[model samples]
Target: MSTDPHANQFGELAWFKSSYSGTSGGDCVEVAATPAAVHVRDSKRPQAASLTISAEQWSAFAAYARQA
Candidate 1:
């Protein structure tokens, strides 16, 4: 999805790691949410590019994950 002109960039966003993730940080992703989008990136490489999806899409995926 295309980002709006006013959307928050990666550095400006506040990211969160999953509560279940290990403190030693093996394989996990960090997530950040904005009003219009959800951002996901590897916890090991925060500076790398992230996947951004619409909030609606994220909610749908989250529901599916819960079911899985």
Candidate 2:
């Protein structure tokens, strides 16, 4: 939740938004994934703080989300 916005460490990751997000600029979520970790951020605030989690944790969360 605390990566320097100007750092290039995460700049190389290809981030993408959800297809379910509206085109009219409402709330949106974006994601980027590496072999070891997954990154999540608000689409409306790309420069703001983002969240990083392990791939295994993402898998578990995705599974729970699917159930909900």
Candidate 3:
């Protein structure tokens, strides 16, 4: 969880929110994808620190989530 924007070395990535997100904006996250990594952040606090993981890791996690 690097707070430094430069840590990821990806500049100004476009983030997309989940379609399941509600108007009330409860627990939800927005994700930005790049060739090398996937960035995840709280939709409620877009300016806050984000979690960065490899694209492969994200794909695996997404597959596991689909199973659940």
Among the numbered candidates, top TM-score falls to 1
Question: lDDT by residue for model 3 over 1-68, one digit each (tens)?
Answer: 66656245565778888777868879999899989999999888888889989999999999999999
Candidate 1 lDDT score at position 55: 100
Pairs of colliding residues, candidate 3: none
Where is model 2 more than 4 Å wrong at Cα?
1-11
* Cα-based lDDT at residue 20, candidate 1: 91
What is the lDDT, from 0 to 100, of the residue 26 in candidate 2?
92
lDDT over C-alpha atoms for residue 43 of model 1: 88
Q: Each candidate: RMSD to true structure?
A: 5.1, 3.8, 3.7
How does each model score on lDDT? Answer: 0.83, 0.82, 0.84
lDDT minimum window of 10 residues, candidate 2: 1-10
| Tens-digit lDDT string for candidate 2 (1-68) | 43656234545667898777869999888898988888899988988888989999999999999999
For candidate 2, the lDDT comes to 0.82
Off by over 4 Å in 3: 1-10
User: TM-score for model 1?
Assistant: 0.83
